[model samples]
Target: MKASRVASARSWLRTSNVPSDEYLEGIYYVQGRDFVDAGIVSSEIKKNLKEKGIPESIIRKVAVVTFEAEVNIISYAEQGTIQYYVEPGSITIEAKDIGIGIEDIELAQQEGYSTADDSIREMGFGAGMGLANIRKYSDEFEITSVPKEGTYLRSTIYVNGK
Candidate 1:
């Protein structure tokens, strides 16, 4: 397979009619050196989603997916950004990170597979369930990755869920 390409999120923003950068409520730069700071970033996501009028139920689901995705950046990647956007009837969460791309997405998606060190596990993550949970909670999901470049995850949870 060819290396995944980078797709600017401009199209989605334009399609949603929300200014590409205007819709972004908050941005977080997560690094491996500080897990607490990264964890705190979760609240920013929640606040923005709430302000967007996303249903509490759906927001909870989005939170699960977002937190899991953000933790992946913290544990594996050097640093990354978590961007938030609001659309007509949904909240979008995008995680972009520069890290060693997953060589086998199929294997990485397995519920019990993990490459995290003991330090991560002791912190209450790295149970190898982040991706699985992300898959479980996100209503719409897409992941693109490049070996030496990075990984990008886009997910949406509708405000009025089906």
Candidate 2:
């Protein structure tokens, strides 16, 4: 976290009624709907990364990956949360949801392979590019899912542009 953001966050913590732990943990909730709040979620992450003085290239990649991951939860899960932490040389993003999980991780990562339905497809998304795009932008990626339990995705991008 940057000095400005840290100071702002501390001010928010003092004024806001939300828990301090959640703020410290950097968790953001997501709600799936006809059109989920994917942009809002992504922008928040971008704002934090920018405040930290992360490179623009890295910020852009993180924004894209974050949006895709959020949309996946919105399209497939009942609810989910995106958790992120900034370390000295890297930032980690973890998305967890409770909904129908992917049956095949490998297949899902294939470009142009999507399980999105017609409605979601109509929204200009679900082109089978979400996972592939995410992977393209992430330096490291990991996904885990079960039949009915849910899915979890973790991605890490190096801050030093490594």
Candidate 3:
């Protein structure tokens, strides 16, 4: 099952949009309960931003947001995809997942509030700061979830700190 999930993720990555001169846009598929894969996707995004000459400070913010989002997907969702767009003045990241969605968005946004299982905690993650951190590092953020259905998170970081 794990192998098949990884294969599906790899296949999605391969078929995603190729970076263009005007802007960079791509989607990374993530499989739930896959602890290691989250970091891989986060690092790839960081590398891409660095290669594009994005300022270190902005890159750092994006990295944190991406990592937090990835961790959330891995820890809770059954499956998800992170889509990123680097445009003229901003970088936008959208994560959508099919999973046991949050029951309370308000409560979930609080720092130190987590629904992680023992396995997630054992992995040294799920300290309940993912959503809060993601919102903190983003210039704009929005999240919506349907219980037992899924969640959608969108975050944007402006290049000029807008």
TM-score of each: 0.80, 0.81, 0.91
Q: What does the lDDT come to for candidate 3?
A: 0.86
lDDT of 1 by residue, 1-162 (tens): 111111222111111233343354556666643454445556666766666565789878877877888788878886677776676677788889988877888888899899988767877999889888888888888888887677899888877886
Model 2 agreement with the true structure over 1-162: per-residue lDDT tens digits: 345544443333211122332232367777654253446678877877666566899789888988899888878987778877767677788999999899999999999998888767766789999999988889999999996889999999887876
* All candidates in order of lDDT, best leading: 3, 2, 1
Q: Clashing residue pairs, candidate 3? A: none
lDDT for model 1 comes to: 0.71
The stretch of ten residues in a row with the least summed lDDT in candidate 2 is 13-22
Error of model 1, residue 68, in angstroms: 0.5
User: Which structure is stronger by TM-score: 1 or 2?
Assistant: 2
lDDT of 3 by residue, 22-126 (tens): 788778888888875666677888888887788999989888988888889889999998888989889999999999999999999999998889878777788
Note the Cα lDDT for every prediction shown: 0.71, 0.76, 0.86
- Runs of candidate 2 with Cα error greater than 4 angstroms are 1-25, 34-36
Residue 5 in model 2: lDDT: 46
> Number of the top candidate by TM-score?
3
